[model samples]
Target: MATSEQMEAYSQFWSLTLGFAAPFALKAAVKLDIFNIVSKFSSEQGATLDEIIQELRIKHDADSIQAERLFRLLRFLVFKKVLALNGARYGLTPMSRLLVSHGSSSDVFVGGILSFCTSEVTQRSWQHVDAAIKRPGDSNAFVEAHGMEPQDYVAAHPEFWKVIEDFRLSISTATSATITRVYDGFKSVKRLVDVGGDTGSFLAQIVRLYPHIQAVNFDLPRVIANAPAYPGVENVPGDAMDFVPPGDGIFLKSFLHMFADADAAKIVKNCHSALESDGKIIICDMVMDEGKELHLQLDMMFLSGSQRYQRTKAGWKNLLESCGFGSVRFFEADPFSITEAIKN
Candidate 1:
């Protein structure tokens, strides 16, 4: 009775409308530690529903009903490709592997971001996105929803701070690997400074690659106070908005996207001042490209949660050039892009 094309369009409309289902399912799996539990077994062997339930320590008087509900959840996850099913056993898929925490500080886990984004606080903030859009002058939806800035909220709630820290560490770990592989501009540097470097995690990786370079991990006093000593990396407590440490090469990874253009420019100007003659400043942030869905989605999140958004290539050029940098070059990288400029 219905045309095939018409049915297909209807299906797509429903899928887009119910898109929240997939991410919420993922959040549940991560919260239940499903990936980590299944990761203990080989894919070939996998983990049975019963075994998974045992690991979860789920107990009920009506065991069969509980198992059936969980099985349905797992089946949904398998359909989403977050998990794989071989016969009656379940295993972690490649996507699920990124969600598993191996208890390593350097390891990247999507769970933190997943948990943070799905939490009640974040969900409430999304409700005010319309308010943020209609409001005048740099209004943040999160601030409107929570009555405080994101950082202040995190500080107030220690649990959320841990989630934020985990998310940052995961992103920094992945970004550091890409930087060391694709960008060779660091080779000429004698001293390098990482602005807003959390616990020196990223700077540690850089110094490990180039032992000749002296590295400074610069951040606020509270952040630096918790930083462990990494060989060849000095933890310096300071604010980038006020003063950035002097260095021939200054790095800002996933930092500029946190501010509006004017504030970002001020930070860059500070980096320019701290640079020696002919010194370089390297930035790692999302440079929005046409048809890149992830970049656009991140831009939306920035729009709703803060007064920041991803920059386009022209925007990056304008910001850097205005801050007294020359010869800006952009490099393609996963999760983030690399931009390098030299002091004029």
Candidate 2:
């Protein structure tokens, strides 16, 4: 017979397993624009369930059953603490307020991230995790489930890819802000080269913050073509693997995690070669550390030969030092780390 304590622990495991339900519910709420609808109709007393349903136009002639089901969903959200219910009305809580989409430029697309994370294409990858473990190497969950890489899959589905792209852009904006605020080494650099800089957003933020710094956003030719112009920032067309534009400072913001260690080392060597004698190399990325098990799980979800995975602090230090850089230092930021390495 199972002991009471052991059974209790098993029950807790089941509860943790059921955590998927919350994200699924949140995904539906995002699709229905529940938060936006509630925000639009909210008053001092908050909005009634009927008002929300009416605003969303989800009612039909057979109303009771559907209304009850919608009520159940709303009540789930209430139970999850994303919303609140008093009397017959529901109101947005701080958590729910994040779903409201409002911003003209450089807005963080929290809703887009929510949707993309729970989207069919992304969730499909999780379904094959078991298979990936059973059969390792070049056959990740994503590859097994989709029969193609993520970028190729996105190219085939333009509309869906746009949402993912929006999420990427939002992440880029947030990352740029963090790098700009915490890292001050940019002051010494006259020329900054952003290797694999996508859309020039990072360089744009950097040059605007430090007017004295001139930056080159270097990526593939097609990537450079689509980059937005920023004052004192030039978009250069070339592969970083082949050659990085010679500069006093080399910035690799979220660039290296996508490649395997060997390839990343090659890119780091390229940075070393391109950097001036006294110049510094800055890398903005997730650094695996203590109490980051959840981050490790998310890292594993990328899966495969040269997928986006984090490096440990020591791993980063060793990698930089191996690339002929000395005096490496790490600056911790929100869910990411900035590593600075000076040429030997």
Number of the predicted model whose TM-score against the real structure is largest? 1
Question: Model 2 over residues 1-344: C-alpha lDDT tens digits?
Answer: 99999999999999979978988898878777777778765445778887877866752333443678778899899999988888888987777776766533224346666776777888888888778778857667887788887767767877876776676676776677676678788888999999988888778877877899989999999778878888888989998778889999999877798787888899999999998897899998888875777666557556532246578989899889999999999888867779999999
**Candidate 1, 79-131: lDDT as tens digits:** 98988999989987778888888743225666767776777877888789888
Candidate 2 colliding pairs: none
Per-prediction TM-score to the true structure, in the order listed: 0.90, 0.84
Tell me how far the alpha carbon of residue 167 in candidate 2 is from the true structure, in angstroms, after superposition: 2.5
lDDT value, candidate 2, whole model:
0.80
